[model samples]
Target chain A: MAVGIKDLAREAGLSVATVSKALNEYADVSEETRQRVREIARLLNYQPNVTARGLQSRRTNMVGLVIPTMEPHLSDDPYFLDLLAGIADEAAEHEFALLLTRCAPGPKERTCYQKIVRGRRVDGLIVVRTRSQDQRVAYLLEEGFPFVTFGRTDQGLDFPFVDVDGTQGVYDATRYLIGLGHRRIGFIAAPEGLMFGFHRQEGFRKAMEEAGLAMEPGLLARGDLTLQSGDVAMGQLLDRDPPPTAVVACNDLMALGAMRAARKRGLWVGRDLAVVGFDDTHVAAHSRPSLTTVSQPIYDIGILLCRMLLQTLQGKPLEVRQILLRPALVIRESSGGTIS
Target chain B: MAVGIKDLAREAGLSVATVSKALNEYADVSEETRQRVREIARLLNYQPNVTARGLQSRRTNMVGLVIPTMEPHLSDDPYFLDLLAGIADEAAEHEFALLLTRCAPGPKERTCYQKIVRGRRVDGLIVVRTRSQDQRVAYLLEEGFPFVTFGRTDQGLDFPFVDVDGTQGVYDATRYLIGLGHRRIGFIAAPEGLMFGFHRQEGFRKAMEEAGLAMEPGLLARGDLTLQSGDVAMGQLLDRDPPPTAVVACNDLMALGAMRAARKRGLWVGRDLAVVGFDDTHVAAHSRPSLTTVSQPIYDIGILLCRMLLQTLQGKPLEVRQILLRPALVIRESSGGTIS
Candidate 1:
């Protein structure tokens, strides 16, 4: 029903093989032939010449991105969005395409990933959100697939990865809180098991520990990285006897939530609580009495990841395999109060 | 660095072709041979299967998606993200791989698209944000490529498409305002050229025209669908001799901006200036004086689009090539005011 190679050949007055070679940019074909074929192809909107695909293998040159399902927080997190924008920008520049797939945990999620991997689809993978022992990373490792992760692994697998210096970012966030004369500053950390939660928790603890501050065990409260979680965690923290004056939320959503909850309790956010957050998300600015937070170089990270992966694909030696960088602290209205 | 098929064949005491056929689920291979070949391949984590790919052609079994660059209005529009999630879910279910690409306008955008189409990137394409008389669709039409679109097309091409009942949605949105006895309702519409803007305007026009209401030319205004644009439009509308009591923004971000500008002008949003927004994005719910908006089945639209494309690629005819889905109006605090 549609035009075939024979039709194209008859129309162009060239042999089918010559048409195929010229259309495919084969070195054997003359530039004039290639140009003529390309012009016709463009004019006709002719499909790719797949006959020589055996030689070229029809490289899609498209990368596949798989974000874990459980962390809707990553999507809600402005910081993560910035990182994604960076990756998108980099991919756009390199003339390469990217496929983004987000899967949650379930039989459905596992089956979906299995089908893609089993069908020999996708050239490489980019994964975010790593648990201390994440199954997805482990599976990719065992499958001997090429992948770059945004989170670190303690499992000792030598996979290529680029991650922010969350420990240092938290360190900066904590030090700022302390500078406001907040000695009993509490840390609203993520669930202690995940890599980010652990790193941020460590940073807060290390800063407090180095400062020779003594605190009760209940000062460190955990929340899943959500605004709701922050609200709930703040409730629990406030319930304790003699609650801390200042709190550092490991992520921005929690900070926003904490601010809301504090306001509800007639507590002035910056003056009464002196709260700080990480991942200076977009809402961090719009929130009443805007949030003081940590700003990660997300766009730069995406560009760096792209350059690293491209170089590795092109067989160029790289100076660094694992990149760990720091985030800057952005002062806003949320943490403006001087600690009593 | 990796085990070759020849080496595996020698180890398994079979011909290279026989080993490959067994590993690949070929009918000629016995079950016993297949099991043993699979075990060996698993052990090797064998990379580079493109050699055997040379033996056959057709049906790379991949799906393609093209979206515009991540502008704040589009990327942060929860509607698109929700739609993407739905598409990803359905694509995953069919075991189909996705080729995601962001189209920028100009040489880079053209090359990015050209590489995907001419490079034999995917089995089909799914285009988001369809414009009236879109060139991309025209190009695909001229190329005879298989593709699906998530928005309406003015090109009159016979292609599969899934679209929200945008006309109906806007019509209903305006009718709700009319029900509240608001006569001088304003529409803060998108740039006049897009198909989406056209449909939304049609809906609004239809409702007013059907109700025998004469719309003043000054009552209709256009914005680029940014928060800033919304702010500017709101300011301009407020400066009119007799300002509109109610205004509907075609997109949620613009509505938020309108609300902000209203607050800036010291007008109570829900009480003094009733506002409504389309595309019940996440920000709409979180916005101060939460917005009244229409909820398009964004995620469901994605799933339906992907399913239709998958069916088209599988030799199944698209039974319903054009799908105009319904939208639900989420009645919130914004438009619940009493009219004089």
Candidate 2:
């Protein structure tokens, strides 16, 4: 049987109530006595039942994160891992654990959120992949639960979030392509409903309009943010009567996919065609003809999100409730800049 | 305020005790009353107090996993991400959530184990990176807690585990190197204390011994399983008199690092110095000179470990208490075999 407060009390020569007070660090208990009781408890390996204690304190000291079940893509994507490492490290530093749940997209996702929130499995939650509608955000707001999102929602809800500036990042990439004298640039966008997708699309349109270039509807394609999807989308764009000289993908995975499609068509990346991607993940640096992409500090975003949520859970006033981090474009060979 | 059993009872026009029994699915409660109570509770968003319920049931339905704080490297490595995706997916399928903690190595790691185990924060745990004399394993064994390890311990304690066959993996890589007529080969090994490291080293020695080759002390170097460490270790091996013509790293990260070191010395990877790495991670295939490495189903291992732990937690007898999966050798450009 597991050792308990009674065991500590017996070993410390104290009453059960006194041992409990000492363990709980009640101000009424003398420091010396508390120390002695704690030492005894440590020696006995006495473990206080956290579940029982949570009933009284209403705090589990855990932060919940629900990831979408992206399957094969998730296993290969280093983005989420970087974010998780950051959150796990920060949570550990703050004496908190991270609770992870994987939910499929759609109705099941809402059920997953309700199970965690209503069950009170964690003190707070960190939500990722915010959408235009974002029922998850709506539910959390209605329930008045503490949460921080990795992206913003179209609903314009007032909530704590840390999001990368997708618009500016994509706009800069598009401007770079335009500067390279590419009048017709293909764009592989994230699927509809994702707020980031909308921002990225807006950036592309703004860049084209500012450059006095008419965007051919045939040059725009949507992908499900997968390498395969990107390949198919790029293939469609390449089939245009007058194909684009360059392409911009919403994410590195899609960008790499576009490169693959270019290669399949006997086009050498960085020479025959220029490709740019967003989210400079680990694969972006190691991929053949290394990707030129927009870099976001994904790991740091996770750390800041956790810190914000923990502060909120502690009922502390946040200096900044929402954070919008600007992403920088990283130049590499894939953008055709290395061709001399 | 959060909806309670009383509120659910009031809405359903039933006594609080009857509502509670109905929600708990007691056979004593009629099916019609149970359905009415459940529908009312769902409409009102009545979340049962899991904390209070846990006090009665002694089950949290959570599985704990503690990763080492190997920052910088952790973010770049896809191996852990794949494993995590597997475990997270399986846990969700089984209606369990994963509790994650990041702990530094050494004495503090033990403290982390104590906190999670003693606090009863999870129904079971999944331990990774097992050591030869793992105190965490010993403590879990002593506590009689439900846990399954990703690797084995050398303490001769019979426990449930799912591990890759490191010895066989390295043995095959070594034999393949010998087949390529490389008499002198350097081995970049994992740090001490890790059980996998020991087994991998043993495989290297066995292969060299069987080949009637004399092992040179200067050719052997140890790395802390990071790319930087692998680079440093490879540098030391190259500094030796008549440095080995080929090198085998314990992991893909170190192997890639060793390749970097070779290039810095103005040696062509596939022509001058053959390099091999274990853990055919995603980067292994994408690296400039694709790595010839040992492939383990890391993600599948994660899934199996979770299934085993959940089975144990549910008091189900395992078909196999211990699993040792054989890793395959995937030959690529790095090992000099692709030079035509």
DockQ of all predictions against the true structure, Cα-based: 0.24, 0.63
The pairs that clash in candidate 2 are none
C-alpha root-mean-square deviation, each candidate = 4.1, 2.3
Candidate 1 residue pairs that clash: none
TM-scores for chain A, candidates in order? 0.90, 0.96
> How well does candidate 2 reproduce the true complex, by DockQ?
0.63
lDDT of 1 at A306: 70
TM-score of chain B of each: 0.92, 0.95
Distance (Å) between predicted and true CA of B312, model 2?
1.0
* Cα lDDT for residue A118, candidate 2: 85
